[model samples]
Target: MDWREQQPYARKQGESFDVKYTGSCYCGAVKFKASSDPVDAKFCHCTGCQSLHGAPMQWAAIFHKKDILFDEDALDNINFYDSENKQNVRHLPCKISCKQCRSPIADEGRNMMLMFPVAFKIDRRNIPHAFKPTCHIFYGQRVADIKDGMPKFEGHKDHSNKIEE
Candidate 1:
């Protein structure tokens, strides 16, 4: 069946994830691109994720910051803020958004970025299999239960899972 077909905000026209992909903020005030590096995807249900995305869950894919290309002007229109980590300490800038629209563009760190799939211009039908979300993280904090077959991790993916029998 279709992945995430139940999603509310449908992708914008002309969004496609191919060998290489480009993405932008909701208002197109900022844009960037990444090579087809087979980034892994994750569905996060932590409270931080929920509040940050203003949703119950956040769908994200990992990419090396070096692979992403953006226009200098577009970069100028972006803002940065550090999110408190599990330790409750502010780290490097984590939240990056378009200043014009205040729409989040990505979660950037030293070398990696966790991108929102909706920000990319990819047709649901054309999304690469590798880009498909494989697990639910921080399942313990879910605001609403998701009954998908994917493993539900009680914490991080490498840790234990919460399986209901």
Candidate 2:
């Protein structure tokens, strides 16, 4: 299926952000920018996220879809993978990554983009002051445990903490 079909969020228009952040892939073949601040930042322990990112959890900064911009030349360097398994398709991320170097770029969901703040061109040590992981989502799916003490939510941290049966 076309990747756009996997995007549940309709592309927003006319929104703007004063502050812009830029990022690139490991090989520098892919680059992008985002505007405004994050709606929320969190650690996602969902199996799909962990598998796509090859990490225990993904640190993501949420932004309105319109706020993200990719350069023209780097357009072809990006690709999407549908992370849908058995759950509703609308609920999973359409994982975006760099084709050349294979860096996990963003997790696109309905209405927003969950990006890796580590990709932002900012000082690494300033991460906490810049973006903070407010909660942990899909903690039940985690392969490993982190003692971060952040509120662990079973479904979506903001929407519901109850585990889905």
Candidate 3:
């Protein structure tokens, strides 16, 4: 099975699961709803992520763009910043944040959006198994060492060397 297939939320053919997540910015100016299970979840230790999030790592849940629905206020309350290419922001991948509070939201890719799990309203003790991070990516760039047993990839999962503990 593919690495992603191991995720609890990875449904097989003809199988179905229903889960929803609601979240908003710190100031509550930007709200969103994810009506489906995430495609994947992981702890990212990339330098860009650390710098942008102001932390050593970032936990993000991946979802199809269509699965995420922004509230009507999003049009005016959200801002997109393309850290790689600034010329055509909307046409390329970018980071989405609240215009008022500047809270980091999601990283918008071509088809997937990596939503910051911290923004969601979830019970800390009852987080769903599927929402738990499965691995660490960009481990080589990490500023802090994580001794968790989860797979640690020096770069992108499946595309880079796995760091053995």
- Local distance difference test scores for all models: 0.72, 0.72, 0.81
Residue-wise C-alpha lDDT for candidate 1, range 1-165, written one tens digit per residue: 231121111223564433388778989988777766536898999998898889999998888665565654575676767766533222554677788988877776666778888888888887777679988999989988898889888888878767551
Most TM-score-accurate candidate = 3
- Tell me the TM-score of each prediction against the true structure: 0.79, 0.77, 0.85
Model 1 C-alpha lDDT versus the unseen true structure: 0.72
Give residue 120's lDDT in candidate 2 (0 to 100).
Answer: 82
* Per-model tally of clashing residue pairs: 3, 0, 0
With candidate 2 superimposed using the best TM-score fit, by how many Å does residue 46's alpha carbon deviate from the native? Answer: 1.3
| Location of the lowest summed lDDT over 10 successive residues in candidate 2 | 3-12
Residue 62 lDDT (model 3): 96
Q: Per-residue CA lDDT of candidate 3, range 28-99, in tens?
A: 998887878788999999999999888999999999876777765565777878787764244447788888
| Candidate 2 error regions (>4 Å) | 1-19, 85-93, 128-130, 162-165
lDDT over C-alpha atoms for residue 66 of model 3: 62
Q: What shift in Å separates residue 34 of candidate 1 from its native position after superposition?
A: 0.7
Tens digits of per-residue lDDT, candidate 2, 63-109, equal: 87777776657767877676666432334457777889988878777
